[model samples]
Target: MSSRLINEYLREDKLPHIWCPGCSHGITMRAIVKAIDNLNIEKNNICIVSGIGCSSRAPGYMDFNTLHTTHGRALAFATGIKMANPKLKVIVITGDGDCAAIGGNHLIHAARRNIDITTIVFNNNIYGMTGGQYSPTTPQGERGTTAPFGNIDKNFNLCNLVKAAGATYTGRSTAYHVNMITKLVEEGIKNKGFSFIETLSICPTYYGRKNKKGNVVDMMNYLKNNSINVKAAEKLSDEQLKDKIIVGELYKTQEPEYTEEYKKIIESFQKER
Candidate 1:
C-alpha cells in the first residue's frame, strides 16, 4: 500500500519495483521524495539525474523531469542541466560504484566547482547491479564476486573526500535511519552550493548473501547499533570508532555557487557589449 505522498511523487504505473526484498534503495528513494514533500518544493521545478546502476533506475520511476544517463556520468549531465537552467533544482541519484569509481573525476570536480546541485549516493558497498562486484566504498577485506577471498583495495570515505574537495555540505546516513536521511537531504537541497550525501543502503541479495551479513533484519540492526552521530563520535577513540558509522551532517560551510558565478560573468559580458 503506497502512501499518498508516494503515489504523488512516484510514478504509479511503475509499481512493484524490481529491487529485491530487503533492498534499502527503496528506503533512501522515499526519503528523497519525503524531503521534497516536506520542503514543499514545486515538483515540476525538480530535475532528477541518475547514472546506470540499481540506484540510477530511480529516475525512471519518478514523475519529475528525469534524465537517465550513461554509467558513471550522471553528475556530468546534471551539471549541464543546472548550468543551462539555473532555476531548476538538480539532484543526482547514484550508487557507490557509479559515483566513486568510474565517475570519481566528475564527482571531485563538481564539488571543487561548488555547483548548486544535490548528490545522493546509495553506497551499498558492492556493485549490486553489476553482479556484486566490490565498489570503491567496499570495506577492506569484505568479500565480493570480484574479490572472492576479500577486498584488498582501500575504501573511500566519501564524506571526507567531498568535504576536502570543497563541497558546501556533506552528510551520511543509513537506510535504518530514515528520519536522518530525509533531514540530511532537505538540508542538502536548501544548501546554496555543492551538497553531497551518502546513504548506506542494504543490498541483501548480493552483499548480504555473499558476506553472510544475515537477513535484512540483521543488517538493519547492525546499522542501528554500529552507528554514531558525528558529534557523539567526537568523544570516541579510533579503535572504538572502528566498524561504526559516523552519521549526520558531517560538514558544511558557505561558498559561492558555480551557477551564480557564471551568471555574474554573463552579466558582465553583456555590459561590455
Candidate 2:
C-alpha cells in the first residue's frame, strides 16, 4: 500500500512521463521524491521551479508548488520565491543547456548569493528536447547535430563553477547511482545555503544516438564501471582517470544563507523604527 503522503503529493494526472526509454529523467524524478520523503517536509512548504526543456517538464509532474518557467529562467523565478517567502524550500531542475548555457548567469549569481535553494542540474550533455544541439557541458570531440565532425569546445565543470561562486554545498552524481543521488538531494535540502547537484543523466535517445553511444543500458553500464568516488579519484592519475566519472560530494561548508540575512536586516530596521 502506498503512503497517504506520497499519494496525496504526487500529481497522478501526469502519470507516465514522456521521457524516452533508458532516459534518466524518470529515475532522477524518483530520487527527488525519495529525498523529499526522507526529509519529511510538508508538501506546502516545497516549491519546484524548472525552465524550458525536457528536464523543465519535471515541475508539471511533481505535486509541490511548481512553476515551469521560460527557458533558462527557472533560477530567476526560484530566487524570487526564496526572497519573497524565505521559509519555503525551493528547488530548481534544469538541463545542461538550461543551466550551463542560457541560464549560466542566473546559476552563478544564485550561488554567489548563497540563497537557501537547491539547484539540480540534469546534465545529459545535449539539448535533448529541441533536437540534439551541443550544450556547454557536452564533452569535447562529442558529436551532436551542431557538431557533426566533432565538438571543439571544452565542457563546463559545474561543481567547480558553483563551488567557486560560493555555494555552501556542492555534489555530483549520475542516474546509474540512484541511491547516492537521492541521498545528495536530501542533504542539499537540509543544507542552510545554496546547494547545487550536477546529475549526469543519460539521454540515450538524443545524446547517445548522435554520439554513437549505445542505448540506455549501455550508458548505465558505462557509468557504473567508469565512476569512482571523488576520494578514490584523488589517488588516480590523469591517465587512469580518463573516461571515468567522478561522483561524490566535492565541497561543503556552512555560510549564512541570503534569505536569512535579508530577514534579519528587515527585523533590525523594524526594531529601530
The model with the greatest TM-score is: 1
State TM-scores per candidate: 0.99, 0.96
RMSD of 1: 0.8
Best by lDDT: 1
Lowest-sum lDDT 10-residue window in model 1: 1-10
Give stretches of model 2 more than 4 Å off: 1-8
Expressed as tens digits, the lDDT of each residue in 1-273 for candidate 1 is: 678988899998997789999999989999999999999999999999999999999999888999999999999999999999999999999999999999999999999999999999999999998799999998999999999999999999999999999999999999999999999999999999999999999999999999999999999999999999999999989999998999999999999999999999999999998
Taken over the whole model, the C-alpha lDDT of each candidate is: 0.95, 0.91
